[model samples]
Target: MMMQISIDPASNKHSLLNVMHRFIAAANNMDETIMVPSLLRDVPLEEQANNNNNNDDDDDVAETQVASNKQRDMYEHYLLLKSIKNDMEWGLLKREMSSGASFLEIAVKQEEEEQQQPSVKRDLAVEDNADLEHQFHYHLRGLFGVLSKLTLQADHLTNRYKREIGGGNFMR
Candidate 1:
C-alpha cells in the first residue's frame, strides 16, 4: 500500500495562520549561532547607535540587535511575505497585490549598495573582527528594513480593520 500527504493549494485562512504560527514557533526554538547572523543587514552606525541610545543595559541592547540575525536568510524573506500577509489578514495596507513592488525596488537598491562597499585603508588595518562586524552590519540593515516595513503594514491593516468593523458594544 502507498500513502500520500498533500497540501491543498487553496487552504483556508485559519490553516494558513496555523502554519505561520508554527513557523514562528520553530524560529523561536532555533539555536543562537544559526539565528543571530540571519537577522542582520547593514544599518548605518548612526542609526544603530540611536537604536541603542536608550538606558537599557548593553547586554539587553546587544541581545535585541543580535536576535534579528538568528533566523535563516530564506526565513527572513518569508517573514517579509508573512508580514504582508498579516497586514492583509488584519486589514492594514490596501488589499491590492502590489505588496512586493515598492519594497522590492528598495531592497534591490540596498543590495546594490551592499555590493559596492569599499575595501580601503581601514580594511587593511582591521582584522577578522572587522569582517565579522561587517557581516553583522549587513544582516542588521536587512533586519531593520524588514521590521520597519512590517510594522507600518501591520499598523495600516489594523486601522483599516477597525474602520471597517466599527466599534461595538462590549460582550465581556
Candidate 2:
C-alpha cells in the first residue's frame, strides 16, 4: 500500500521538523506503513494551513507514545514464537525419553524456572487447555531449577573441602 502523506511544510518549523523526523525513523525501522498516518494525524491540514497551532508539546508526546507501542509490539511478537518453539522442543524430549533420568530431570527443572521467573508476558497457553507439549514446558523448567541448585551446592561443598585439605576429591 502506498501511503501518500501530505504535510504542510509551510507550518511552524517544529511540526514540520517532527514530521520529517518520524518519516526518517519509519524508514530506518522498515516501518514505512506507520509513517503517513502518524505524521498526518499530528499535523492536520487545517492547522497546518492556519499557521496557528497550539499543540506543539502534544505532538512530541504522541510521537514518543507511538514509538513505545511499536517497540512493545515487536517484543511480543518475538516472545510468542520463542515460547512456542521452547514448548515444542520440551514436548519432544519428554515423548522420546520418558524412562530416562535425564529427560525426567529436565522436565522437572523447566517447570520450576517458569514458576520462579517474571517475564514480560505469561505463557499464552492456559494450563487447563494446554496439550502435552505445553505442559512439559512447565515441568521442564522446574526440573532444571532444582538440578542447577543442587549442582551449585555440591560444587561449593567440594571447593570448601579441597581448601581444607591438601588433596581432596569428591564424586558420588
Predicted candidate 1 versus true structure: per-residue lDDT over 1-172, tens digit per residue = 8999887643643343444444343333332222332222332111234434442454343334444544433234334545554564565433333565575676787678766875643465576565888887787667555554443333322222233234321112
Could you tally the backbone clashes for each prediction? 21, 19
lDDT of 2: 0.39
TM-score of predicted model 2? 0.22
Deviation in angstroms for 153 in model 1? 0.6
Q: Give the TM-score (vs. native) of candidate 1.
A: 0.25
In model 2, what is the error at residue 131, expressed in angstroms? Answer: 2.8
Q: Deviation in angstroms for 76 in model 1?
A: 17
For candidate 2, lDDT tens digit of each residue in 28-86?
A: 33222222222222221122323224335543333333343343332242233333334
lDDT of every model, 2 decimals: 0.42, 0.39
For candidate 2, give the lDDT of residue 165.
31
